[model samples]
Target: MTDDLPVLRGLLASGAPLTWVFTGDSITHGLIHTRGARNYVDHLHELIRGDAGRVQDTVVNTAITGWRADLILGDFARRVTHWRPDVVTLMIGTNDCTTQWLDPVIEVTAFAASITEVVRRARDDGGIPVLQTPPTVDLHHAPDRARIGEFAQAVREVAAREGVILVDQHAAFTAFSEGTGPGNDDMAWGLLDDAFHPNAAGHALLALGWADALGFDAVSSPVRTDLAARVAVARHPQWPPA
Candidate 1:
């Protein structure tokens, strides 16, 4: 078992209810591109509540659309602290990548520092922190956020430095897109709804990654989302950036 699995499993084994808080940007907000489909957090909710027998457990998404790491840090106490979560899942860096380039004050190092502080605060509140790297995007489609890979790396570095659990969604998605990873996901189908957010198909992979990290094996359940993906790609194959 990986070091991270035990931390989450121990909490479940404790026989007490688990309170999970998911915080980040739009992707974590699980809107727009989802097209009325359930996002990753929703899928995990079913698995945790249905399969894991944590029906009483509370899972909340405190993410705000278009928000950044620093914003989350600034509002940490209210968004995260008040809940006193047992497990905190953080996925960000998409917007931060753009602002780090366009905005004078926000840089990669500062982004990393802000993310690190978020994790630190979660830990301080007696919560287990899990860092999820933002999924890879079409660099051609989202040029302003081209440096997202660097920010994704920043998350990896922080997870290592903080010794927290990490779900490397960026790497996983890249491998699938490039035909390098197990399971036929990646670019064979349209994982992204557009340049900015993931559709239901993409969200499935996100949920799969989280379920794997937590030792749950809830398969993708986006039948309608899959059909939507087919139609989307047929209409615009290059929308996802090649």
Candidate 2:
């Protein structure tokens, strides 16, 4: 999270009501494995409301499972502009990076274009767009993790060109997985519900990133780590029944 995003800074300082639209794929939806509540969007909404003195916000999740960037594009008009969101976070690209279904180059290129259009639409509709790099995938199943990086870079480039806030969730997940920074520990494995969809702990990481980007004081680092640990331990397959 950087301090240079004037648009986001303005949004935070206004202290007015805000409608936040989160659009992405399964990860954003946090489906079957997470039961929805544990996803980052939900956690972020909760954190926003917890701070009584902060901005009053309405968070809406319009993400669908197994959808690509094109599909999301089709719904943007109806799902986003129609709702008139104040802030929009777009976090797609996982399905777009699939190795088997489509041409990687074609898919990624389309993805980038779609994301750029999404940002444009959001801004045109009087909303500030926050572009998020997709979280890293499990290397075991996703051998072409490099493709993921390419897609993430595309998001970064789009954010730079569009002058919108960019949250580097991919980097955050990598750091968390590697345990490289201060208070960072090995929490990546437990973060995943499977090879793809992130579990509760994983979503917390995303929530923290978004919170940090928005300059919110909610959910401290230690708290996030503890929460991840709790989720991992409680849900570990070998744990005895209560």
Candidate 3:
């Protein structure tokens, strides 16, 4: 048994390149930004490169706007098979929770099963699977917390049972937004204009949470000069106050 443990550790520590596949909805798709590069997936790439010092990591974002779990499962093999990622991060279920068509519990269960299947398939290819619970939306406006919470719990249960890592962004974001943690509510200013999709601040939070989950230190590099200029422009008003 002692030898077996070292053998397993050796297999896991072989220093292979890591490909991270991020799948979800519009938030994962990086909407409402001037460039197509303001989503959490992009931020995650930046953090990994900055901290890991030339790791062989690639992030493929396959999150389409308004997509539900069923839709994602239908296309999984075709879309996700080729990359053979080292880690796959899945954040879904918000849209499914919004639907009144299916039983919430059943929908969530089926979603969990579908996601588990994907993780298992990735395992067959030597990939690590991670689950990210959907973030809490401004439920006061739409008020789907009960259903969303159920779905989030289901995801967490699956992660635990499967021994996969789960990043509970739902809990993290709520704590941050409600003034209970290190989150910046003002950061939600333009990012969560509709409360569903996040702006830059929301993406930043995602990046930070992902870094924590991956056991990596937070990114310490100076912000890109061009990005800083854009952020500065966003902070200041236009000339003559259009």
Candidate 4:
């Protein structure tokens, strides 16, 4: 870890103003809650602004609920390329592991290829790519532990081969799920609601993992936002409504 600090520092100091594009399923989309600040992306935005001391950093959340890797890749060719973010983080595979698409090996391989392609395109267009393994879900409720593990492994392999950074969120979440440390609680496994989608606590855990992967000091402080305010601004009559 000591030896890696210099490299991390260098990456941080790079002249480019950091622009992160987060892509994935409902987690990335910030679902299971009302529109506005309740989602992870909003939490992430506040965290970055407070910790990094710069609100100029760009972040785009292109996540759609119930999306798979293939669907995400389809949009990558258009939306992602246009954004050209400095770093792209992906948190997918949950939807792919559903019973509707249970071919773990094939799905993992395809997902990995999609990620590789996105990275390659980013490089060609001048950008850095970072991949994140999906967080650990409630296996008791989801009943797809083996497939999830396989998907995580595939993400790691793809990241290595592509020379991109990989955040092993699955492993970290598992450590917490198994009662390893501070995050050792049922909420850490996103089981509070008996669903795979994480609650506020779960998203907070993810933000910490992201901070570590990005070589920033881990801070557990929560940055609360006014959901009504954000929604009001987003839905202003001057702008188009979703």
Candidate 5:
């Protein structure tokens, strides 16, 4: 509704085949937290190819475990540009908040600079850049990284200043936490596998946000609700079978 992804919509609406490259840290990598389940990009891949009838659309995931924006820049061309993607999705800043032995300001400043550089390089290399803010974490368990909110703020600023397509995953997760976050123990609000990494359900939320932003009719997809539906079985006995 806000016209956030006009360029991407144009590409999709044009009905021409296009490639999308996803790069970021473990969150985007669909690490152990996903427990062998598909990540958000996988869901998007299905939407673009199967649902949207764009069978030729390509989705590549070059995300790495424990990597940050600075680390991605170290080998940008290989991980991103080499694919000659039409759209490049960046969902970083989580690990940037936890980098060891660096001042908070320094880490965020470097993170912002690295993000900016990635956007510039993506645009220069003929790719539309899409920025996704890192999702929320359980501060009670990750007390050391309590200031992660600052990093989210930084991503918002970067998105606004860069004038690129913005997907506010952090805001979405934050709203979820505010509404249904457990009173205690389940600090992650049942969305994360641990204190940080998102689990399958969390990944579904991420997918839903991206899908909605990319103008997909996501409400009917398993990616839009409890992803466990795709598991072919209900997560709890109290719930009906998927």
Candidate 6:
């Protein structure tokens, strides 16, 4: 088993309730993109519960819409540490990288420090910290997608330096989108609700990524699939919306 898996496995083995907190921006909060539908965060909790008997895991989402790394840092104690989580996942940086050309260096430096502090705080609170790179933006233009990619790299650097579990969602989304065809544009559009937020289909792709990152193969559940399908169809009648 991977080093990261041991702690999670032990948590499951212990049979005690597990509290996991997911903190980030609108993505983690499931904004307009997932208003009435299930997002990655929702599916991830279910994915972890799986078929494990008596594994009661509570997932607390402290993410707010349009929150940047600095904003998150300011509210860390009240939103994150107060939950007393057993596992804490940090997935910020999307907002921090927007229009980064205006303050590229500051964005990089401040973003990195914010991520490092989040992980450090989680550790100090006796929670296992997991770092997730923010998924890419659909816009391929100058200050949008490329800069987000840069911030994703910053997240990777922090994960390595902090020695926390790294869930490379940015890379996973890129690969998943690339498999669709030639340029990354088409796949990027296919998954996004807007330039930034993910639709239900995009959320499913995210759930898959989180499962892979956690070293757990997801079991298809008819209940969850049906719920997702109903929501997807209701949102957009088009069969292959994504």
TM-score, cand. 3: 0.75
Candidate 2, residues 1-242: lDDT per residue as tens digits? 33336766676777778888998888888778675456788777667665434445788999888777778778778768978998888888888887767654446677789899988888889888888998878766666544888899999988887677899988877765453333324335656776667877778777778777877644344445555565446333331114
RMSD of each: 4.8, 4.7, 6.1, 8.9, 4.3, 4.1
User: Alpha-carbon error at 184 in model 4, in Å?
Assistant: 9.3
Each model's backbone clash number: 2, 0, 1, 0, 0, 0
**What TM-score, to 2 decimals, does candidate 2 have?**
0.82
Clash total of candidate 2: 0
| Candidate 5 local lDDT, 1-242, one digit each (tens) | 33347777787778899999999998999977888887888888887777677889899999998788888899998989899999899998877886444555446777788889999999899998888999887876677666677888888888888887788988877765443423533243556777888877778778877877777854355444445453222222221115
Winner of 2 and 4 under lDDT: 2
Better of 4 and 5 by lDDT: 5
Candidate 6 segments exceeding 4 Å error: 1-3, 53-55, 100-105, 140-145, 182-187, 218-242
Off by over 4 Å in 4: 1-11, 14-16, 33-37, 101-106, 144-146, 180-192, 218-242
Q: Tell me the deviation in Å of residue 45 in model 2.
A: 1.1
TM-score of 1: 0.84
lDDT of 2 at 104: 44
User: What local lDDT does model 1 show for residue 126?
Assistant: 89
- In model 3, the Cα lDDT at residue 123 comes to 73
Per-model lDDT: 0.79, 0.73, 0.65, 0.65, 0.77, 0.73
Compared with the true structure, the alpha-carbon lDDT of candidate 2 equals 0.73
Predicted candidate 3 versus true structure: per-residue lDDT over 117-208, tens digit per residue = 86677677666777888877666555653477788888888888877777887776565444322334422232354546665656666666
Point to the candidate with the largest TM-score: 5
Model 1: lDDT of residue 122: 94
At residue 150, candidate 3 shows an lDDT of 82
For model 5, the superposed segments whose C-alpha errors exceed 4 Å read: 1-4, 99-105, 181-187, 218-242
| Minimal lDDT window, size 10, model 4 | 232-241
Q: Tell me how many residue pairs clash in candidate 5.
A: 0
The candidate with the higher TM-score, 2 or 6, is 6
